[model samples]
Target: MFFKIFIFLLFFIQSSYAHELRPAIANLNIYEEDNITNATLSIRLNLEAIIAEVDINHSNTKESKQSDKYESLRNMSAVELLEKFNSKIKNLQNKIYLISTNSNYNLVLLNIDIPGVGNTNVARDTIVDFDIQNIKDEDLKFFWDKNLGSIILRVNSPNNEDLYSKLIATGKKSDWFNPKNKKEVDFFDNIRSYTHLGFKHIIPKGLDHILFVLALFLLTPKIKPLLLQVSIFTLAHTITLFLGVLNLIKIPSVIVEPIIALSICFIAIENLFTENIKKTRPYIIFIFGLLHGLGFAGILNEIGISDGLFISSLISFNVGVELGQISVIFLSYVFIALLFQKRLWYRNKVTRPLSLIIASIGLYWFIQRLFF
Candidate 1:
């Protein structure tokens, strides 16, 4: 019965193609010259995704309804698409909200550029530039349109030549900033933001990490064994996460992702043969955790940690990841181990069966990532 259920889930998960939760990037350049505060905002995003978000008639339009038209837009030259995008400038402007200490500033569309023709399988970058005037040098708050996916805001001050960056969701504004002086983000605020980033990565977005943790849980029902493994895994990943972020060690995602998937498969396969935790299991987990840490660092590298608060950001994010991992283990204990650990059929029906399903998915990912 479990084997049949597993087969169905494997096929279902593989078939579903949901929109990826990739982050869009926005670069904000703020500088003051001749008693004038000038701001230029350049936003890069997936063109099709933005169109789908803002176009009210998109569902009924050919771009959304017809695959061929969508492909044409995707493959259109950067200049060609920029011309088409000109019509939607107002809609895009309405989505980006900016406010200064003295007054709210309107973003005027300056220009738009698409990098190149993109395809359905690959996302293309569409860059939109905006001009802002009538701004004071005081604290400024900025936000992107909520309809857009997650956005990573990079704020740069040409006057001082300093860089500050943060990730913000739709409708959420960023931290206040002054371009003239070194902006110091509060320690607690830094912790709060990065912690949320870490937790979100694990709970909703970190499917691969979730599966890896689950594979460890299936190895035993006892808390002692689980805690020992979890502690070792956490320590191992923390070491490499910091190392990778500092650029002391660099491993390309092409290699790291496949290896991470293989680690999941290895653990799940081992569970099928070993009922008790193996003496070498912790050592194996420690190694796998090192790879997983690099994965975590990859995310930080993308969003960027503020230079002023690098250590705080790193520690807070790691703390959130640990919290996320613990939550996974606790939930598994309640829903799986505590509920059926002593059942006569638990080993054959639950543990072994679930392990096989996880193993299958991991192996599938391994092959897909490695060869395809």
Candidate 2:
């Protein structure tokens, strides 16, 4: 019964993890002028093609209600009400973007001069909006009057509504071919009203990401294999991250996420039975990491940062993520590696169980993500 339960758990995990992981892309662009930083912002999901889904239920309900004799025409139409609400929601969530630092904020009311859309320069006016809630500093006057060239936009949340409000401009990050100049671009970087500390989304807090990496490294416990897999994953993620951000390649979250979860479960299961990683492990990891990285990028994409200073920001953010991942690996090794040294049966009992557990958790995530 114990063995049977373990097997059942294994299948459950595989199924769940397979559907939970979504793929996204993060990209940053920095624009500079006259040595002083003019705009340094990061843009995420600038090129996401949100395929509109027709609401059949809504249509059917509206038709049925119209045919009802008892219902008054004056009565609030559910379909009409839904349509109005959805429209407002869609407008707010068109291209969600977040401004990172809202402290001592300079809410510039920018009338962007898109080359084709408007008259002249993109950063023409310098009228800043005022929000007293975020102003904690005594010297708030500096942000109000000074023409400080530096503008940093960062994403705090990655929800649909947030994306529509914060993300200023929309286009492929890599669309250098049709250089519409800065004026024709979308989101303009002007600081907003919010908290002082740097803000980011909560997606990184997911346990599946950790388990995926853990499962990948548990088998060999050797530096070489670990390094190879890590390197491949990093490289693959980088490629897709860039591509996804630029809108060069767009993969829907619904499809990409579940697959990533499945990948985690599969790796853990393989570790349970297979002793050798085989030479192709690195290659496979790279491919999957590419998908996973895109998902990570999605958070950043929702937040808009200036085109200037994007390089430094991107490098720093990527490094920060890497450091976080490495810290997890170190802690796990310290906690589990020493145990393996003491007992040979540790491989069969502890390692396998741990792998199974990881796989099970991943499976659960997959199911919840897909069905829910």
Candidate 3:
């Protein structure tokens, strides 16, 4: 019966990947010369998601649903996809809105290049080059329509050699990007933005991190033990996260990802045979936290942190992540520990069972990530 139940849970967890959320990335490069402004925006996103967002009939379909037409689009060669986009360039342009302080300028479709075939596992980039009259004197803001997934925007200003990046959600407009605007973000505002980034990473997005933290939570029934472990974990990760962002310490995802999965399995499995936190557990957690911190840095590096705002952004993001971690701990206490910690059967029925499930998932992830 135990084996049957475990199998069922494993299968259920495997099926959950179909509903996973993926964010789109848009890299916008704009430069002005000779009174003309040229812009090249390269957007990388899942073709099926974009199709579901744009197609009238399929717009209402859930992104997880498999579509034959969408698969065909995904299989198309770069030239073929470019041709199709060229034919419907106007419609595509309308989906992304750009406005200057004084007037809205149209983005003329110059060219499109879809990635070459052979990496179906990865999202493809659609390069769109266009030009508009130089709006150096005015503020410019841009946004995409609703139903498009989260967007990471990178803006390059040639005038001052400043690079600005921000995460913009669907239907949300970006901050005004102007070459002449030399103003640095206020400390409080920097804290607010980066803190949100850090929090969002953990709450809705950081499933792996959540599992790791949960593993730590199940290690002992007492709050003191858990708090000590969490504090050490936080400190360890903070150090590596800052080092990783500064490029002083670097580890590739290929190595770090699988090790992280294994760490989750290790902690959760150890909980089955141990009732109290071991003296060595804190050290182990600290090491795992270091790995997790590198993971966090990878995320920030992807969306980017401006050179000028680096220190403030890093500190704010770390604080937000700590808040997120605390929230997770609080939720675990309310939902699990408070209700079951005192029960005679808690160890056998609650902690062991849940730890086994978590360990199984972690082991599966380890195999999948390392081999596949």
Best by lDDT: 1
lDDT of 2 by residue, 193-264 (tens): 111101122123444566777887787677777777777877887678667766788888887888788888
C-alpha lDDT of residue 106 in model 2: 33
**lDDT of model 1 at residue 173?**
79
Clash counts per candidate, in order, are 0, 43, 0
Deviation in angstroms for 64 in model 3? 5.2
User: In what order do the candidates fall by lDDT, top score first?
Assistant: 1, 3, 2
Q: Is candidate 2 or candidate 3 better by TM-score?
A: 3
lDDT of 3 by residue, 1-372 (tens): 666777876765443332344556776677777866656666766554465344322312223455445556767887776666555667667877678777887777665556686544334555555555455566778788766656777777666354566778656788887644543546676679889989978885677788889888987758888899899989999999999999999999999989989998999999999998888888899999999999999988777787788898999999889989999999999999999999999889888988898899889978877886
Q: Cα deviation of 292 in candidate 2 (Å)?
A: 0.5
Give the candidate number with the greatest TM-score: 3
Q: State TM-scores per candidate.
A: 0.83, 0.51, 0.85
Residue pairs that clash (backbone atoms under 3 angstroms), model 3 = none
Instruction: Give the Cα-based TM-score of candidate 2 against the true structure.
Output: 0.51
lDDT of 2 at 167: 27
lDDT of 2: 0.46
